[model samples]
Target: MSTLRPGRRFRTALRLAGIAAAFAAPPLAAGAVHFSRIAPLTGYAPAPAFDAPDIDVPFDPGKRTAVVVMSNTGTELTDFLAPYEVLAATGAFNVLAVAPEARITPLGAGLDIVPHLSFAGYDARIGADPDVLVVPFINDWRGAANRPVVAWIKAHAGPGTTLLTICGGAVTLAETGLLDGRRATTYWDFFAWVPRAYPAVQWVQGQRFVDDGNIVSSAGIANGIPATLHVVEKILGKAVALETARKVGYAPVAQLADPRFTLGMSPLPAVLLANAFRFDKTEMGVVLHDGVGEIDLAAVLDTYPRSGTTLTRLVADTRRVVRSRHGLFLVPRWDFASAPRLDRVVVPGARGALDDAPLAAWARDRHGVGVTYLRGDLGAPLAADRFPFDLTLADLARGESAAVARWSARGLEYTPEDPAVLAGAGWPIGIVVWPMALGLLGVALGTLGVRAVRTRA
Candidate 1:
């Protein structure tokens, strides 16, 4: 199980594309339109059955999930622990804490969590099959020259068992050849090295997570929780994942990157003006510019906390860790006013100074509009009167908000009781995007060719 080469990466991507096409359509005449209207402006038409009867998977609570923990540092501990706590709370499956050995492994800061089983001690005795395996990314990701974990995965992980990794763990996955030909993602920091180090892994940069059948790779660190919750949503149901998050007080920032940060300091109106002129698409990318800070997000989940030591490091240093390891992009929440660039912006709050003279003039000049006000605590209110295409992190979290339901591009169908509800019902769209998607591969390759020819000429 060595890493895949570039040629294999291309072929594997095609195979995955075929699977996606199969999942997207139903068996029917080539040009049948069942669910939605289609004008068929393009003469060439290929529309199988897109909306098939929903498939419901039966839930078996007795199933067990094995989580691999790192003894190195605490960076990955929170990502591991948060999801572990949230998932274990469900009692749907037993979670085993494993490390290199059965000794006490030091996690974030001075906190040491003892491993239940050592990798060596881990016998197939736990069960003939593993429901899922979680790998944490803690150390210098790219510098990982030797990958013992990958060898272990090749030996242990099977088709029925899901191999999941977060952030740096994706690097290890690359070595195992599991993700070699699949679309996957890690922390934003590793985006550059993915193609260079293991070009076989089709990297989708902006995606929060990639689900290639049994393999699930999430963005980074904390994002692993949401990605795992997505699994719970798929397996048990949406309502269950929502309850788990609510139980943990974890409000999912469903969008990839907060849009506010991306909009920069430009007046909201100016930002919206630019976005209005941008071309339309089958799926629009939602970016939350100003993501949340660690403490702020932790505070939302801090129900019965103990030491300030872990909390302090998580908020202050973790921010730096994310930046150093990744970049400014890791901030859990960001200020939209500080975005570096803004083609167009959607101003949610109209009452703010963003409505002032300078901001007003900027919006007027750009022709941006005040769409609707989004509340951070409650969630985005769906205005039967008006619904904007751009929804914020806060907007998507409202579990029962009618504005969210009615205005939902694809209305929220999952109830609070269902365990399979998508993360704010946005994952299907997110998965389709698959992080730096190559849907436009031909255009990209052609552009690169033109540039090469021009340079040589």
Candidate 2:
């Protein structure tokens, strides 16, 4: 199915404002009470739900055209893999991951990879020029390790070799003087920053890419997929680009023409959740749930579909695949270390508390700045000491959902285990269960009466 359009995007933005207004009670008096006086995020308001991307296009390896992806120690996985996977699936290109060193290179998150070609190794071993050179976003644009790779691009990649860059990878290519004084684009989060970094290059906004004949640059990590689709069209044909996009369940957008890259990045301090886990929502909603065990988040993902604030799942470890309580596996967008800075975090409750020390450390470090959500035992130490909110889990669970509103400003969403364990659950399932229980009792009684009459006869 297609994604939500601009109108719904606007409505969701407004709905988020409404949720924030609902939760923020009483005027903030000058010097009387601070904004911190508000309770910790208790629970989330409801939102339109959406299914995570599940298109599994089969890989077909045929054409041996050389496609080399340049990387360093801290390459963003999505920026590299999204385009690499798209190109590899076409069976048209031979993809190789090349780094600066011969040894195994550690990547973002906890993942590691062995390079197919090192800067010097490629020249001595393969010795042949590749048709396409892909540069992924790295942790730092001006890292010392990237000097060799930049030199390689400068020497070989020009006019004949199609050099494609994802997000901040443009900076790497720009260092070669290739993109200098040429139209280019980078990740939206750094839309302004990139231009400031290299004023010589004309950084274009409101578009997915700036394809200046031989070079191609994309907006962000997720936007890389669309940018690569444009490349597929350039190499293979329009038919292939459309076919690849269709098989992958993504519509092929026009080249050099995606305006969405500009609008969302202006807002900072957005909420960032680890992207993973399948939820039972209909449309892509605002609030997110990152499952730690075999736990179902159907009830929890219900809140904040239209929540205007940002919500994403961040992988805390090397693992991108997350298995839910029902064996639902999902790949998240961001990992812990590389995730964008945001206001607060929401951790869903599971059957057992996971030993995620890194998350605890991050929370402890940002105790005053951001709210750290811990469902059940997960929040024990953090909440007990720095329980800055006027409300508690117990309070929200017992009282009406309105009490949870205090924490809903940043699109707070949660699913507590055993809602009945509390005085009463504020969700729909908690309130609707009473009538269903009475109906079941009446049905049993009626059946028993009929059996007794039959026995008498």
Q: Where does model 2 exceed 4 Å of error?
A: 1-68, 252-262, 265-457
Worst 10 residues of 2 by lDDT: 269-278
How well is each residue in 1-457 modelled by candidate 1, as lDDT tens digits? 7499989999989867755554333322121331112222111122111222222222244666645544322325445555565566567766666555444333432223345555665653353446777776655433442244455566678777877787677887777778878988776656766789898888877566778888888775556666777767766787887787665545543532221111112222211211222122121111122232222222222210111101111111111112211011122111223222323333222234133454444433543432222322223343311211223322333332222232221211111212212135322232234222433443455557657989999
In lDDT terms, which candidate is top?
Answer: 2
- Please, what is the TM-score per model? 0.44, 0.48
Cα lDDT of model 2 by residue, 1-457, tens digit = 7498989988988866644443332221211232222111111111112233342212224444444455554566556655665676666776666667644443333233445556776677555566778887765557786777778877767456787888778888888888887888886557657777788999888676778887888776556667788888888887888776654435435532443433312111111110111111112111123443211121122122212122333344433445432222333344555454544454544223355465556645743233234344322433322211212333333432332322231122121222332233334343234334444555556557657989999
Residue 287 error for model 2, in Å? 23
lDDT score for candidate 1 against the true structure: 0.43
lDDT of each: 0.43, 0.49
Q: Highest TM-score: which candidate?
A: 2
